[model samples]
Target chain A: MSAREEVLARLRAARDVGGSTVPDVPRDYHRTGVHAPGSAAAVERLTETLTDYRATVHRVGDLDGVPAAIAAVLAGSSSVVAPPGLPGEWLGEVTATVRRDDPPLSVADLDRLDAVVTGAAVAIADTGTFVLDALAPDQGRRAISLVPDHHVCVIRAADVVSSVPEALARLAPDGPLTFVSGPSATSDIELDRVEGVHGPRRLDVVLIVPPRA
Target chain B: MTTDLGMPTVASDPHGHLRGTEPFPVAAHRALADTQLRQNLGHATRTIRAKRAAVVGEVDDWEELRRAGECVKADVMARLPELLEQLEASVTARGGVVHWARDAEEANRIVVGLVRETGSDEVVKVKSMATQETGLNEALGAAGIAALETDLAELIVQLSDDKPSHFLVPAIHRNRSEIRDIFLREMPDVDPDLTDEPRRLAMAARAHLRRKFLSARVGISGVNFAVADTGTISVVESEGNGRMCLTLPDTLITVMGVEKVVPTWSDLEVFLQLLPRSSTGERMNPYTSSWSGVTPGDGPQTFHLVLLDNGRSNVLASPDGRQALHCIRCSACLNVCPVYERTGGHAYGSIYPGPIGAVLSPQLTGIDGPDDVNASLPYASSLCGACFDACPVRIDIPHLLVQQRAAAVEAHGRPTAQDLAMRAAAAAMASPGRFSLTERVVKLGRLLSRSGRIRSVPGPGAAAWFGARDMPEPPAETFREWWGRRERS
Candidate 1:
């Protein structure tokens, strides 16, 4: 018999001998946030959680506020890599030279850049996490957000969800996704958390909140 | 007893089973004397334990989540064969190729063959327990391929020529100064003024791994969770080394145990929540990258998934033992285990250590022989239930420990002095006549007592116990005799 056959047979025999039955899963955990979805409280909680993880959270009123927020966050950046299909006006007020990655930048090129400005597909408020799908225009490929030293992500208030289950519901399961909670960190040494290792050291989340009517 | 396809003994393949040369007690004794190791372990485990407790306490439905996680894993085990077939189909439908390995030798051969096909002599690696279990690095080295461990802790263990002592932090046994010395000696272009500060150590490792990540053609990793429905594989880590290895390489080979698979993508929500909080005490880790087979113009274009069944089926054979497969490799059990916190991971001898390892390694290797280190592992624990409480899936490790002990004793065939004592005690307790006679004879213990306690025991098997502890002297009168006197009055 082939190795595959042997393994399958062994598994079958084990299952038969064990005679175990699968039990129904109980999911009584909170699926929604304490604050209503897309509410002001939800945004505030996300900001607090993100800040706790050491990601600078910038609250902007709307799309018009994005350019100023981007400029303020990238004040010291000399050059920034912007993904293809990113709103050009988001970087309008920034003095840093904008490098468009329509053809995608090399890893070395990305490494040299000051920061990468992109948009997130969805954000989780409770855990303070953001998902980036490569197929999404503003998110670009996984390399842009990772290779640069700093990352300034633009997240709309509407995209923020309450919990992990709600966040998973919005993502494409088969697409390449990177769920980043904060700047790269490690607790490997002495169990002490030291931020910044291999990935972007600085993360700035720009919250694009809609102004109250 | 054997039929059709005669199973090859696990001993035939040297790397298939991992067991220490010395018994656990002998190894633990040496470990106990190492005050430095004890201090390091005490500090790390306490810090991690407190952090995990704080985060886990925040969740109101933590118990429910744990139960759900257990059920999901149990379902996977019950339907493992079908799920594996579905996973193979899903992965193959995408651009990935799936290979099956019955043991470590075949797994190593398949991985080496793939690397040879890529024409690459070096492979960058993410921190993978599966690779460690298979001793993949050693196998690759024997085949003339360099497998560079990219994770910081793993790099420390690799550079120092030491085995990993912890699951999350492989070099948890080493202090900061020790790491500094290892880097200065092993790292080629390390800074001369490197200090014992953790940030400096992390920076030195990052700089050392950068060159390899940028130029490597092939990368090797292990799967944290393989979604059978979407053919997607996820790697969760606090550092970005996993992302670098998973993305930059042209060819990627992942070795995953068959039990790592979940039924669907939605099932990840529970694990993604349970793992980080339980393992590193993070709401979510710094980075969690998931991808289906291969993506064009993006991550690795060539992907191979090696499904490993290295004694996992053997573990699944027993009803009580099958819960060992429910482990998520979180190391929560290790952090809370009293035995592990004292002896550390090395005393267990396998790459896997702690309470989970005590049950897992022995079952995986089978405790059928007298001299097997696995047989000794069943006795490594104090039967404390801390590991079960810390376990995200609630594996009932104490119950498994007792069960494995019984199996180990049976495998030994010859009864030791302790076993004889237990048997005699059982026989004496079986009959009322024997019990009363034994109770009447128990007054003789007063003759051996000094002051109010017996300082030493006479038996060879119990000398060690009594050497450190004192037993109280027997009462002047038996309970039955006292009751009779009361009745007479």
Candidate 2:
């Protein structure tokens, strides 16, 4: 028989003999919740976990106060990096110089930018991780969210899920998805934890609660 | 169809010598004698084990996440061929190339040729188990190309010329002082004065590796997952070095095991949560990089994915044994294994070590006689279920270990002495008459000691039992004989 045929035979034999057995899941892995908590509860949980990881979280009750919140975080920054698809309402809160990430910005320009603000694709309520697909209007080239020292991400309560399985069911297949659990951190140096080795130093989560219907 | 990172999977079998064609007793004996190694392993494993337990306990849903991870891997393995073809189609459509290998030689050749085409002598690497298993670094060295290990622990191991002692911490067998000595000796153009302080050592390494990072044109890596639904390869790491290697280079080559595929991008959720908690004892790792084929202006323009088999198909053959492939390389099992705590990873003699290694090595490269340590690998574990409990994939490792041992015994045709002992034991056990005779003979020994302990014994049993532990002596009178006498009275 040919090598290919031999491989095929072996694979066929393996399939025939190696019948599938359902792997034993631990009995105590109870994730079933009859009433999925509302978006507000999820946002609250996200903020709590985010802060627990030492990330700075800001709360904006309305779009009107967003600029103040962004400005307060930026304090006297020379310029702000903004994605081309960023919502106008989101940036009305920031007073810093706005530089769109769409244009070819020099390394010096990126370094000078105080921070970048964008929306997440999915936010896991279980682990409080935010997913960015670069498809969001405000989320620019992957590098923009990554290279900047500070990153501010907006999350709606409706996008939150109780667990990763629930989150996986929500993410789309044909897009760029970047899951941000917390600010970039490393423990490579003798297991002594350090923050912002390559990515953002400060991560601010803006848990925007939609008005009651 | 190109970005930056150069392809270094071009080198053939960079780690070839590690396959363990040597005898297990010899390898294990040498490893056990290293006092420094024992101290290093004992300390390193204990520390990681405690941290993992503490972090894992904090999350109530850890078991659920582990189950999800295991199920997803099983599903992928079941539908692997179709998923792989789909992955290839998606990658090819997005302007990426895919290469297939049946074994280590084929894989090495494909990678080496690719690197030779890049016309580069050095390549940066992410810590990839696939490369380690295939011996890609050694292969690269043979081809006169240097494979620079960028992961901190891996870098330390490479500089010291020692094998990785643990899955997660490669230099787990080295203490701070040893690491400092290795750096001072091996590091090119080092400062005259170097302290044993970790931060200072890290700074030195950073300074040392910074030039390699900037200068290297090619990068080789292994993926944590390759999403078939979207045609993207993903890497999850604690260090941003993975990102630098993934991004800055001109050509990129990723060697992925067939078992690392997931059916959809959505499935990443299960693994994202599982890998971090199990691996680094964290809620989430810092950097997770995913790229599909190639993009016009960002990341590596020339992308090549080498689909490695190397004996995974053989593993997928056994009924109970196939579950070994579901492991996520989290190293949680190693951290919890008591046997692994003492003997360490080097004793296993495979790139994949610990409980996973016990079952996996025998299957991958069959249970061979004479110079094969892989056969004896099954005996390295104490059959404790800690590995199974700690396993993120929930592989029933003890069951597999027993199964492998059975296969080994059958293959070796059984030792004559063991066969004779088993026959005698069975005969004694089957008949009450023969058993009573043996009991009567042992009754005199109980007269010597009132204590429920045996000081020593004579013959083969004595030698085997007394080697590591003490054995208790026999009783004064047989129960049957005492009963008979009472009935007569």
**Model 1, C-alpha of B357: deviation from truth (Å):** 0.7
Q: Candidate 2 on B1-489: residue-level lDDT in tens? A: 112121111112334434564655566777778887778777777666676777678677777777777787777666666677788889898888988776677677788889999999999999998888888887888899899998877989999888886667777777778878999999988885998776567667766876676566899999899989789888887656676677657799999987898888766766776777777777677667787887655557888998876666667767668889898888888878887877777877777778887787778777655235677778777797999998888899999989987777777554645456677878887888889877876776775553776666566655554555565676456678789999999
DockQ of 1: 0.69
Can you write out model 1's per-residue Cα lDDT over B122-215, one digit (the tens) per residue?
A: 9999999988888888899999999999999999999999989888999889889999999999999999999999989999988998888888
Q: Candidate 2: which stretches are off by over 4 Å?
A: A1-9, A20-38, A71-82, A87-99, A103-118, A148-162, A187-196, A201-213, B1-18, B21-43, B58-65, B175-216, B413-416, B440-466, B479-489
Instruction: List per-prediction Cα lDDT, in the order shown.
Output: 0.88, 0.72
What docking class should model 2 receive?
Answer: acceptable
Worst 10 residues of 1 chain B by lDDT: B4-13
